[model samples]
Target: MSGSEDLLELAVETAREAGRMLVDKRPVDGPDVVQTKSSPTDVVTQMDRAAERLIVERIRAARPDDAFLGEEGGTSAGVSGVRWVIDPIDGTVNYLYDLPDWAVSIAAEVDGVAVAGVVEMPRRGETCTALRGGGALLRSATGARDLQVNAAVPLGQALVATGFGYAAERRARQAEVLTGVLPRVRDIRRGGSCCVDMCSLAAGRVDAYYERGVQAWDVAAGSLIVEEAGGLVGGLHGAPAGPEITIAAGPGTFEALHDLLAPLDPARD
Candidate 1:
């Protein structure tokens, strides 16, 4: 059986390889088959499927007994007591428009807990990796640096990052939640990539992050990165982060934001 550190290495390597494939497959003029899911604004491309295939292929080769739950591909069972949660093109809209926020995310879960995660943002020219209890690290053109959330920033002056859902109604309700939470913070940033936004929080590039109706693949990798970086991850109202909502922040900032937005939680609303 592979150890957590080994699994972490495998996750990072696979994510980076998939990221390079995505970058090469990216179109200069227009992406092929710009498809939509859930809403018109939500997008996907041929590259998304291809990248997922590559990741699944590689992971299967390494750990044939492990399970998989991919954004592009549905769940597949295995007997290895491990499951891989992956998002081939995390920010497909950004990738379609040739923006820099898109990423390839992969996370490994042992039993039911995330033990390793990797997010490779080719356009951003950085890769983030985290191992449970080991900590998170960011690698770029310069070098690698340990990640840590900014605990010093107070709620009023915090620069929070976030993403929206695919449904118009969800987006509308999210907008309402934002307005309520926005005035209490320094400002807002909508990067269109949940994986990137959460990694930014891990790197302390942003003070916090929150989103609703996110799937397991969406936050599986990024949320682990945040937790390993000394940040907090949970639902809007002390519940655990799941499909409902994902809220991440530094120690003090986490408490403040959760309190401010708990009322906006869709499950409760």
Candidate 2:
């Protein structure tokens, strides 16, 4: 963690570069290219590829021996212990719709642990960065400031944010789960970007967040930011977070929120 600041800088730089590429290529109505992945709802566009290529190109140029994993592209092995995990465009649908919630996320992991993370929302002109031990910070045209979640907020009054997977079955299950969760909390917001949701929690914009079937690149950086911002993160049923499910919140609401969602755990679905 102490040695992670440099890596954090690198991640921030990479995210900024990738974010600019996405903004420059912002689709006018719709992007030039669009492709389906596992389903019709899950789509990718030329901007995703272009941004990922730009990000990978920058990281590969700087750290040739470092491994890389990206949402648009697959994995690239390297000798360096540092592995750069990336999401060129975190909210593809948002980007496609020209929504302001999309972002570029990048994280640096050493020995399978995230040491530094960065998320950039180009349209919002917002950047969130964090190192393993260092604190989380959010930057905008206004200025930069340290990030801290509103841990004192009670679970009942907390504003929760979440996202559903693209699969129809998964969406259906998540909807049912939300039906139960909505009445228990203040309200729920369906933000399109995972990084944005996590960073928003870090900035005290949201009280809690959880999602199932999140890709590694989706939460990698954002989780670190949450942790550094005095928040807790865990997977479904106290398991380590992965592609299954992830829940993040301040210490006060973590357990209570987790307990409430345990019955609806997507891992069980």
Candidate 3:
């Protein structure tokens, strides 16, 4: 297999491994297994640590020289040829609550540009994959199939997905923007996971998704999936998404959403 093919295979395998661990560990009766990370609301659990270890170990074994950046474990040095970004569990809060919206996200960056990605929703048995030049895929037990964004809805009449930031100040800003946007759009949802939110947008389940105070690992995989699926993924200003934040929308709705969010001035208002 080619280099991209190899990365794709590893991403899918590692994600599935993590997903299995998450699905198998739910409690029948007891308090959830949770602990504070950065804060009380910023939660982590045994499954998160185990999943990150599994993903890191697999990638290290397969490509010993490739760099790694994960949500739980922070960053590690590696050769410059390739870097793997992993989010072992994207929606830990939901997962702890026994919600079905969590996912394992993985992406490969070549020379700092994402070339391939995989987002696996364990409970739903859905795996969304994408390559830089190749199109996107929605995989399930039924079969593997191509995916694309739907552009039928206008910007004002479309549903949008978003999430709150971990910090109080950032969350306040997000609320401010929501105040401006809610009345103008069809609807808005806070789905608890930026990775899954972006994938849902890519799959045309929602018209757009934008959020501030997100890490690169949260959206790296999903952003590429959106772009490869014929959607636009970028910053709130409609520029290329970076390590800072993400703003993604379908072709039909991106421009208007960008305009609506510009006043927030994520950098300086």
C-alpha local distance difference test of each model: 0.88, 0.88, 0.83
| lDDT against true structure, model 2 | 0.88
- On the 0 to 100 scale, the lDDT of residue 184 in model 3 is 84
TM-score-superior candidate, 2 or 3: 2
Model 1: weakest 10-residue lDDT segment is 260-269
Q: What is the lDDT of residue 56 in candidate 3?
A: 94
Clash statistics: count for each candidate:
0, 0, 0
Q: Candidate 3: where are CA atoms >4 Å away?
A: 29-35, 266-269
Per-model TM-score, in order, reads 0.95, 0.96, 0.93
Q: What is the lDDT of residue 258 in candidate 1?
A: 84
How do the residues 14-62 of candidate 2 rate in per-residue lDDT, one tens digit apiece?
A: 8888788777767667886568986898999988888888888887887
lDDT of 3 by residue, 144-249 (tens): 8887886646767889898886667766776877898898889998889888888888888999887776788998899899999899887755466754557788
Query: TM-score winner among the candidates?
Result: 2
Q: Model 3 misses residue 132 by how many Å?
A: 0.9
Q: How displaced is residue 70 in candidate 3, in Å? A: 0.9
- Assess candidate 1 and give its lDDT: 0.88
The superposed Cα distance between candidate 3 and the true structure at residue 234, in angstroms, equals 1.0
